[model samples]
Target: MRLTMLTFGLFAGPAFAQPGPPAEGPDEIVVTGQKRDGTLQDADASITVLDAEAIDQARLRDFRQLDDLVPNVQFNEAGQLSNVFITIRGVESNPFIVNRAAVYIDGIPFRELTNAVLSQVESIEVLRGPQGTLYGANSESGLIVIRTRAPSRDAEGEVRVTGSLFSGTGGAGIEAYYSTPLVSDTLAASLAVKYGREATWMRNRAAGVTEPGEIEERFVHGRLRWTPSDRTTLNATAYLLDINAPGLFDNDFFPQDRTLYDQLYGALNGGRPSGRYGYFHDAPKRTDETEYVLGLSVAHEVGSGTVDAAVSYRRDRSDSLGLDFDFTSLPTAAGRDDNDQRVTNAELRYASAQQQPLSFLAGVAYFRDDKDNQKSTFVGPGDLDSYVAAPVQTRSIESLSGFGSLRWRPAFVRDVTLSAGLRYDHTRQRAVQREGQLDLGGGSILYYTDARLASTDDAWLPRFSITWEPTDDATFFGTIARGYIPGGFNLAATQENITDPDVLRYRSETMWSYEIGFRVRSADGRFRASGAVFQIDSNNWQEIRVLTDETGRPVSSDFIGSSASIRSRGFEVEASWRAVPGFDLSASFGYADATYLYLFNGIEDLAGNRVKLVPEYDANLSARYQHRSGVFARAAMNFVGAMALDERSYAVQPATTMIDLQLGYENERFTARLFVDNLTNVRRFSGLGFDNLAFGTDGTVYGALEAPRIVGAEVEMRF
Candidate 1:
C-alpha cells in the first residue's frame, strides 16, 4: 500500500517541492478540489500542480506567464490590468464574456479573471474539463485554484527586489512577506506587500508622446489564523490592489492587405511608416482601477466528519478614458467607461473521513453580484465636446446552489473505485438601462431600450467516474461530466423595431465532456508520465453579434445564443524524467480540433469554420541542471499553433515560438538570479480585431502585441 501511494503521487500532477533541502524522490502532492485533502489521483480528474519552487523558478508574477507552461491553455492579456481571459481545451473566453472558467483565490471565487498580483504563494492547481458539479456555474471549461501560504508557528520573513528591461522599457519592483505567531500556541498572522512601476514601451507618433503606456501598481495582503481548540479553527483575510496605466489600450492598427501597408502608413504618418510599437492616437488616454477583498472561514470536527464554512466580499472599480475608436490621429471618435462591481459569496460544507470505504462530501453555496456601468462615446474635434451616444446601466445577479459527491471502494475489488457528483443551481438577474442619446451638433437621436429587464435560469449538472489500479506503478480512469452557463439579459437590448424576445435575452449554454486517461511511474521513481484524450459536445453556444439597420450599417452589438452545435476533441500528454543526479527534463504536447458542426447566423453560414481563439496545437520542453554548490540553470521552449481570429476565418495569427532561460544561485539566507524571457524576441499578438463598423476605417485592423525580449535580475534575503 505504501508503494502504491508513492507511485500514485509521482504520476498524479506536474510537480511538487518542500521548503528545505531537496528530496531524493518526488514529493507527494495533495489537492483540495473535492473540498477535502486528498491525492491528485484520488480526485479522479486531470490536473496540473505547481509548487513554490516551480513558481519561483518560472518567475510567475501574473497569469499571462502560464500560457507557455500549460498545455492546451492560453492566457490572453490585453495590455491592461483588468483585461485578461483564460482559454482551456478550445473553450475560449472573450472580453465581453470573461468567465468561461472560474478562478478561486484561497476559497474566494472570482468569476471575472482580473490581472491580480501573484506573490508569496504556495501552490497553483489547474483542472481541465467541466467542474460545475463541485464549483457551480461559470466553470464549464475548467477551474484554477490558488492557495496562499499560511502563517506558521515560527517567525519568518523575506524581502525581494527585481529590475527588468523589455522592448525599450524599464521597470522595477519590490515585495516583502512576513509571518509570525501572535500567541503562544493559538494564533498566527501573515502579511505581504508589493509595489511596481514600468515605463511605457509604446510611442504615440501623432501625439508626440515618447512614453504613452506608463504603468504603476500596489498590492497588500494580510491574514490571521486562530486555533481555539484541537477541534476548532478560524481564519480571516483581507487584500487590496490598485493599478494606474496611461494609454494602455493604445493598440497598433494596420491594413489587412499586405500591399496597402505603405499606403496606410503614409496616410497615418507623414510619408513614414510606424515602428513596431508606435501608434497614431492623439486623444488623451488613462485607466485607473482599484479592488478590495475580505474573507472569513471556520472549521470544526464533528462525530466522524469535518464541517467547514466560508464567506467573502469583494469590491472592484475602474475608470477608462480613451481607445481612439477610429484608430487614427483624427478625433473622429473616442470612448469613456466607468464601472463598479460588488460581490458576496458564502458556502458551508461537510466532508466524511477519507479512510472509510465510503467517503462523501456535501455543500451549499450562495452568491450575489451588483454592477453599475456607464459608457459614453465622444465625437467631433479633440474628442472633448459633443457626444455620439451615452448610456448608463445597473445590474444585479443572485445565485443559490447545492452540491454533493460520493466515492465508494468495494471490498471485493479493492483496486476499483467508483465516484459520482451532482449539483443544482438557480440564478436570477435584473437589469435597468437608460435610453441613450446621440448629439452630433446637427440633431439629437434617441436610442430607446427596455427600462427594466429580468431573467431566471436553472441547471442540474452531474459527473461520474471510475478508476482502476491494477498495479502499484500504473492507474487508469474514465469520466463523463456535464457543464452549464446561465443566460442573461443583454446590456444593450433595445425595443426600437425589435420584436423577437430571443434578441433581448439569450439561452443558456451547455456541454457534455467524455474523457479517458492513464498515469504511470517507473519502479525506481526516476520517470513519471500521464496522458488523456477527451471529447466535448456543446449546444446553444453564445456568440457576440452586431445589429445592422436597413442600410446594412452596424448600430449596436450584443451576446446572442447560436443555434449551431459545436464539438471539440483533444489529447494531451506530459512527462518528466530525472536524467541524472542533478539533471531533469520535462515535455508536454497538446492537440485540439474544434469546429462548428452546424451554424447559420442571420447573414452567413459558418458550418465548417474552426472556432475562433483556439489554437490547433501547443508544445513545451524544458531542461534544468543544478550543482551541489547551490548553482542552477534552466532553459525552456514553447510553441503555439496558428488560430483563427474571427468566426469567418478572415484573419488569423500565425504560429510562434518563445524561449526562456534562467540562471541562479541559492543558499539558506540569500539568493540571486538572472533570467531572460522571450529570448528570441518573437512578436506575439493576443487578438486581431476588424474595424469596419461605426467610428472605424474600412480596411484597418488593430491588435495588442505582447512585450518583446525581457531581461531581468533579482535578489532575495530571508530572515
Candidate 2:
C-alpha cells in the first residue's frame, strides 16, 4: 500500500471556513461576487465563499461535493448523473458543446450541472476568472452564483435525516423546510422538500445482477417575498427535479491484470464468440430525468440609486435507456437517447450613488433557447434481421445584451480606485438535422440531410480594474479580461468525415485574462490572508471525435475543423486562523499549468498535451472545533493533481487524496451529525471513455469507479 502526492500545501489538508472574524472579534463576508453587494475583503475577484454554516459543515450535496474545496475547481463526473464536465482556470468546454462555465440561480442562467440545486442554499459564490465584463456567453469558464433561502420574519421550520453505511451499497435521505410571514412586514413564504436513494456496487456478470449501479432522487422548492415599501422589493421562485441513474456505459471493466472481483467472474463465459466478453453484460443501462424552474425578482431604491429586475423560466427532459453499445454480452448493439429543453430569461439593472468621484453601472439582457435531440440504435431484432440507427435534432437560440460599468475615485491618489467594463453581444441560431438508417424488411439503407442551418454571432467584451486601499486591513488588485464562446450545429454520423453541410458549423471560443491580487486582514480579525496570480489565453478550442466503419463497425461522430490553442497559468493561496477561543484553522493552495498550444486533430499532434480534466495541483486543509457545551469537531483534507482523460489517450486520473471526518451536536434547536466520506477506501478511477478508442482489440475499456466508503448519519430539527 503506497500513494502520496500532495503537490502544494499550507501545512497540509482542509478548507472551507475562511472568511474571518468571530471568536468574539472582527467579522466580514457578505458577498455577491461583484454584481454589486460587497464585503469579501471588498471584493476584487478570485472569490470563493460558501456559507449557510459552510454548507451545513461540509455536507455539500452537489457540484461533486465541491471538489478541492474550491481551488481551481475540476471535474469529470464519473458515472455521470447527467453529463457533467467543468474546469475553471483551465477553462474547459465542449463535452458536446455549450457551457464554458456559468451557473446562477436567483439571477437565472443554467444549462447543465444537472440544473444546479443545493437544497435551500443561502450563499455560494465562486468567480474565479474571465467573467467577461459582468457575464456574457458562458462567461468563458467562471461564475457560479447562488443565493437562496430568504423569507422568514417570524415562523420557521426544518427537518432532516440521512443514513448510509455501505452494507451492500447503502443509502437513504429525507428533508424538509418551511418559512413564514404572510403580510406581517409585508409578505414572505417558503417551502422545500427532498428525497434520495442509492445503492450500486456493480455486479452483473452476464445477467446475475447483484447491485448494478443505482440512484434515485427528487427535490422541490418554492418561495415568495414582497415588501411594498421602505424602498420596494419582490421575489418569487419555484423548482422541481427528479432523476434516476445508471449509465455512462454501466461500469465494471479493468484490464491490465485481473482483480476487479476476479475480472467479474472471468468475463462471464470467457472471451470471443462474436464479441461477448468482459465486465460481462447483456445490454441494459438507464437514465431518466426531469427538471423545471421559474423565477422573478425586483428591487427598488430610487433616491440614492438602485434598481434591479430579473425573470426566468426553464424546462428540461431527458431519457437514455439501455446503451450497451458494444460492451459485449452480444445483444450485438443497443442505444436510445433523447433530450428536450426550453428556456427564457431577462434582466435589467442600474446602480449609482456612493458619493464622490463618479460611479455607474447599467445592464440589459435577454436570452431564449429551445431544443430537441434524439439518437437511436438497434441491430438485429425482427423482420429480415432488423437494424435501425436514427439521429434527429432541432434547435434555436437567441440572445441580446448590453452592459456598462465605470468607477473612479481620485483626488490626487489617496487610495486609488479605477474600473471599466463593456459588453455587447448578439446571437441567433437555428439548426435542424436528420441522419438515418433502417432496414425493417429491407428498406432505406442510409440517408443524411441537414436543412435549415442558420447562424449569427457577435461579441465584444472587456474589463479593466485597479484598486489599492492602503488601510482598513489592506488590499491591492489588478485585472484585465475578455471572454466569449458561441458557435454550433453539428450532429452527423455514419462514418462521418466532413460530409460538408457547410463543414457542420463549429467555431467561436476566445479568451484573454490577466490578474494580480492581494488581501489581508489581521488587525484583530484573528488573521486572514489571500493571494492570486493568473493568466489565461485561449482560441477556438472545441472537441468531439469518434468515427469508424471498415470492419471495425461503429460509424459516425463529429466536431473538429481547425482551431485550437490554449494556455493557463495559476497561483492562489488562502488562509485563516483563529487559534484559541473556540479554535479554527483553514488553508488552501492551488497551481495549474494547463498546456496545449496549437493542438491537432487531423490525426493527432496534441501540441504540448495536458488539459483534459485539468489538474496540476490543488490542496485544502481544514480544522474546526467549538465548545460551550454544544460540542463540535471537524477535520478535512483534499488534493487532486493528475488528469488526462483523452485527447489521444494515455488514460490518466490519479493523484487523489480525500479525507473527511465530522462529529457534532448543536443547539438553538437540536441537530446531530456524523460523517466519513472516502476516508481511505479509495479504489480510484473516476471516468474515462474513448468510445472504443480506435478499437484495436482493447476496444471497450469503459470505466468508472470511486465512491465507495461513506458512513453518514444526520438528524436535525428546528422550529
Candidate 3:
C-alpha cells in the first residue's frame, strides 16, 4: 500500500473536472511514472502530475501551454508547423538535433514534440530528471508521458465547444468523445475528435492583407479494448492530426526609422535589409502538416508476474512556403521545405508482483525511423526565375535497448526500500544528401556532388535509489542516475561547399545526476507538499557552434560540436492546501543555476555563460473556490525569469508574467465556463531563432510572440 495525493471534487475551469465528490474527504490517485504502478507520493523521482481535471482547468491545449505550470520546464515553438523546442532542468538541444528530451504517448515514443496533443488525454506525467536508466538515450534531460482515457464498461459520451476573441481576431474549438461496451464486460471501444481554428492578429502593411496568421487544425483518436479472460487483455489505438496555416504576416520587426533600417539593410544585404517583422513582400506565411499513429498493447498474467507487449507505427508529413532572405513582396527570395518521416517501434516487458518483499522487472525494445526532406531556396532580384538551390536528403535510424530493475525491502528496515535499474542501448544512424542542379538565371545548370555518412553508438545507463518512510504521512528519498544521448551525422554535412570535417558528426553526451526529495501530507489530509534538490554534471555536451571565416566573420557553416563540461543545479517546491471545505490554494517555485563550465569553439572561451533559453527562475500560484451551489472560480498566474537567447549572451529576452482567470458552473449533466488568458495582455517572445543565410548577419534574431489577451466561453455536455 502507498500514500496518495488527495483530489477534491471541484471544477475551477478546465484542469478541474471530476465525476462527483467522493465519500471520503478527497479522491486518491495512482501514478505509473517509473514503469511501475505506485502512488505519486511514494515515487523516488521529481515529477509533476496533471490529472484530467487539472489539465482541463488550465486550458492547456498543447505542451507549449504547459510551460509555467512545472518547474524548470520550457517549451517554445519556432513558428514552423511542427518544429518545437523543449528544455528540462537547463538541458536543451538544437532544433535539428535528434537527441534530446523524449515524448511518449501510451508507451509509444514520438519524434515530434508538438504531436502530443491534449484532446483525449487522461493524464500527463512530467518526469523532470535524467530518465536514461529505463528510457535510454535522448531522454537524458527528462520525459513526457501521456496516458489517454481507457475504455469503460458502461456507455459514456461528452461534447464541448469553445470560442475566443483577441486583438480583432477570433478563434473557435470543438471536441467530442464517446465510449461504449461492445460485448458487455469483454470488449469496449472509444472514439474522440477535435477541431480548432484561429485568426492571426499580425497585419501586413505592405501586402495590404490582414489576418495572415490564420490556422486550422483537426485531430481524431480511436481505441479498442478486449479482455478474453481475467488474466488477459489487449488494447489498440489510432490517432490522426491535420493542420494548415497560410502566409507570413507580422512575424518580423524592424527599426521605426526608415533611414536607420535602410542603412542596416544596405550594410547586410548590399542594398537594404529586405525584411521587416510586421510587413513582408509578396510571400504569405504558410504551413501544412499531416500525421498518423497506430499502436497496440497486450498484457497477460503468468504465475506471480505479468507479461506486457506493445507495438506502434507512426508517419508524419509537412509542406511549407514562405519568404527567403528579404521579407519583401519581390520574388527576390523564397523558400520551401517538404519533409516526411516514418517510424515503427516494438517492446516487451515482464514484471513480478509487488506484494512480495522483492520485486523485479525487465524489458526489451526496438525502433526504426526513416525520413526524407526536400529543401529549396530561390535567390534573385525581382524576377520569377533566379538562382535556385534545391537539396534532397534522406536519413534513417535504428535503435535497440534492454533494461531491468529490482526493488528490495529488507526485513530489518521496517519501512525502507532500495531499488536499482540499468539499461543498455545501441543505435545506428545514416544520412545521404544530394544537391540539386543549380538553375543559373541563364540557360545553364551546374550539378553538385552527393554526400553520404553514417555513425553508430552504444551506452550503458544505471540508476540507484533509496526510500524511507519514518511515519505514515512523510517519506524521504534519494537517487543517483546516469543519462546518455547518442552521436549522429548531420544532415547538412554533405551539402555543397562545406569544407569543415568537424561538421559531419558530433560525439555522444553523458550526464551524472544526484537528487534528494521528500513528500509529506498533513494528519488531516488537508495539506500536501513535495520538494526536491538536484545537481547534474554533464560531459561532452552537444553544442551547435557558428562557423567563422579567417576574419572572425560569421559564415554559412553551422555544425555539431561539443563543450568540455556543463553543470546544472536546481531545486523545486510544490505545495497545496485545502484551507477550508470549498477553497483550495496551490503554489510551485523553482530556481536553477546552469552554466558552461568549460567551452571553447576553437575561437573563443564560452565558459561561465548561461545556457540559452533556460530561465533561472519559474513560479506559479493559483487559487480556486467551489460551492455546493455548483458555482466555481479560479485565478492563476505564472512567472518566468530573464534568459539569454544565444550562447554569447549577445541578446536577452526579459522576464514576463501571465495571468489567467476562469469561472464556471457544473452539475451532473452539463457545465459552462468563461475564461480569460493573458489577462494583462502581455505580449512577449517565447524564443529566438537564427538564420544566417536569410539575414546575412551572424547575431540577427527572429522569434514568435506569445498569444495576447483572450476571452472565451465553453460549454460541455456529458451523458
Candidate 4:
C-alpha cells in the first residue's frame, strides 16, 4: 500500500497544506529502522510507517489508537494508562510479560509499559518481525521506533485545541509547540507542551458518582541542538509527564455470574445494577504517577562514515489505592500497589556511508534497571489495619550487548543484495521478595515464605536476508531471524505445595521467524501493493499461571513460568490506489493461524488450542476525497475477527466492525476538523482477567471495557 505522507515545513514556511496528486511517482519514504537511513522500498523487512499527517488525521493521541491500523497486530488497554499491551502476529503481551516487544522513543529504551505519549512526533515505524539482531533482549516478537520532531534552524510555532464528547463523558485538550534558533546556523531550541483531562465512560453505582473514572494529564518536552562545526552535531532533551486518575486500576473486576451478581447487587436502593461499564464499589480508587527523563546524543562525521552515541536516564513513580477485588460494595477484599523504577541506558554505534556497494554497522549497548514494588490486600476495610496479605519486592537487572551487520552487493549478481547480522547479549538479574506475616484481625497472624533469587543468562541472536529488484517498480525479499526475551525471577513467594524451581525463576524464551515479501508499484505511481507471508516457532514460551496446592486449592498469586511450544503462521496484503484527481482508496487484510503444539500444566496435556488474544483475521478499508478548494471528507472501516479470551477457551470476544468519518477544511494559517469515531457504539471487552480464585466465585471474569462512540472537533493555528 502507499504509505501515508504528511510533511510540515515547520522551519521553512507554512505548516498546513491541502492534499493533491503528486507530480511524478509516489514520494520516496526513508526509514532509520536499521540504524541507518534508507528507502523503505530497499529494506528487506516488513514495516509500517506513519508520518505526522497520518497521526493527525487519525487523531492518534496514544498507542491504543493503533488497533487495526497495522496487519497482524493489536493494541489493548487494561483499564489504565500504564496497563497497555500490544499483540503482534499471535504473540500476546500481558501485565507480567510486558516486554514481549521492545519500544524505543527518541533513543530512549522502555522495557516496561510507559505512557507512550505521541505529541510532536515526526514519524513512527512498526517493524513486524523479530529485531533482536540489533535491539537485543525483550524484542522477541517485534519492535516499535518513535522519532519526535527535532529542533529546526528557523523560528516557528503552532497551537492546537481539541474537544470531544462520548457517551456519558467528555474531554478537552490543548497543545503548543515552538522552535527557534539561538545562534545563526549554530544552535537551536524547541519546546512542546500538552495538557488534557477526560472522564472515562465507567460509572460507580454504589458510590453514587456519575463519572468516577476521571483522568488528568500534563506533559512538557524540551530539546536543544548545538552544531559546533559542519561535521559534528549534539542534541540534548528533557521530558516530564504527570497523570492523575480517580477510580481507575490496572484492571477492573466484575462477577460473570449474572444470577449471583444481580442477587447481591441488583436490589440495592437507588443504585443501578452492575454491568460491563458500571460497577458497584464504595471505596475510593485512585492512581497518581510521575515520570522524568533526560537524554543526550552526538553524531560526528569520520572519513567516509559516521559515529553516533547516546545516553539516557529515566525515573518513574506510581501509587494506587483501593482496588475492589470483589467488584461489590460489601468490602470483602481490596488491594493497593506502589511502584518505583529507575533506568539508565547508553549506546555507541558506527555506520559506513550508504552510497558504497558494501556497508557495515556495529554497535555496543549497556542497560541497567532497578525496581521496587509493594502490594497489599485487605479483608475487612480498605486500610492497613485490615491487612490480610502484603508483599514487598526489589529487583535489579543489568545487560550488555554487542551487535554488527553487513550488507553486500555482488558484482556478478545484478540487482541483488545480501545481508547478515548478529548480536550477543549477557544479562544478570537479582531479586528479593519479603512476604511478611499477615494479620487476619483479632490477633490472628499468618506467616508466609520469603525468598531471594539470582540468575545470569546469555543469548546469541542472528538474522539473514536477501533482496532482488529486477525492475525499478518491483522488489522481492526473504529473511530469517532469531528473537529472544531474557529470563527473570518471579516476585511472588514460592507456595508450600509447589516444588518446581522453574516456577520461581522462569527460563528465557526464544523464537525463529521466516518470511518472504514483495512490494510493487504502478509505473504512474497511482497504485501500490505489498504482501508478505511468515512463520514463527517459539521455544520455552512464558506465561503467567496460577499455582495450586496438593488438594488442588489455590495458594499465592500467579507467577510467570515456561508453559509450552507454539507455532504461528500468517499472511498479509495491502493496496492503495489514487482512483482519480483528489480521490484515493486504500485497503489491508491479515490472517493468522496460531496454536500451541505442546501445552502441559503439570497435570494434563492440552495441545492444539488456539493462542489467547489473537484474532483469526483483521481488515481495514478507507476512501477519501479532497477538493481543490481546501475541503476534504474521509470514511474508514475496521474489522476484527473472533478470538479466545483465555488459554482454556472459556470466553470469546465475537467479531466486530467499527466505522469512522471525518470532514475538514485547511489553509496556511488556520484549520478545522469534525470527526466521529466508533460511530456504531460497539461495546465489547478488549481484555479478560479470571478472578475465580481471588473472589471464590465460580468462573468470575474481570473484563476490560472498550471505548464507546466519540464525536469530536479540533482547531489549529500557526504563526
- State the lDDT of candidate 2 residue by residue for 283-387, as single tens digits: 556666777777776777787777777777888787765555444454555556678888888878787764647788788888998988776655533221132
Candidate 1's TM-score reads: 0.92
What is the overall TM-score of model 4 with all chains considered together? 0.92
Candidates in order have lDDT scores of 0.74, 0.66, 0.71, 0.74
What is candidate 3's lDDT per residue for 604-714, written digit by digit as tens? Answer: 898999987788888999998889998999999999998877677766677888999999998888989999888998756665544333343433554555566778898
Q: TM-score for each prediction? A: 0.92, 0.34, 0.89, 0.92
Candidate 1 vs candidate 4, lDDT winner: 4
What is candidate 4's lDDT per residue for 628-700, written digit by digit as tens? 8989898999999997776666677789999988999988888899988889988766765554433443444
RMSD, model 3, all Cα superposed?
A: 6.0
Model 2 error, position 159 (Å): 46
Per-residue lDDT tens digits for candidate 1, residues 550-582, read: 543345545455576789999998888989998
lDDT for model 2 comes to: 0.66
Q: After superposition, how far is residue 127 of candidate 4 from its true place, in Å?
A: 0.5
What are the per-model C-alpha RMSD values against the true structure?
5.6, 22.7, 6.0, 4.6
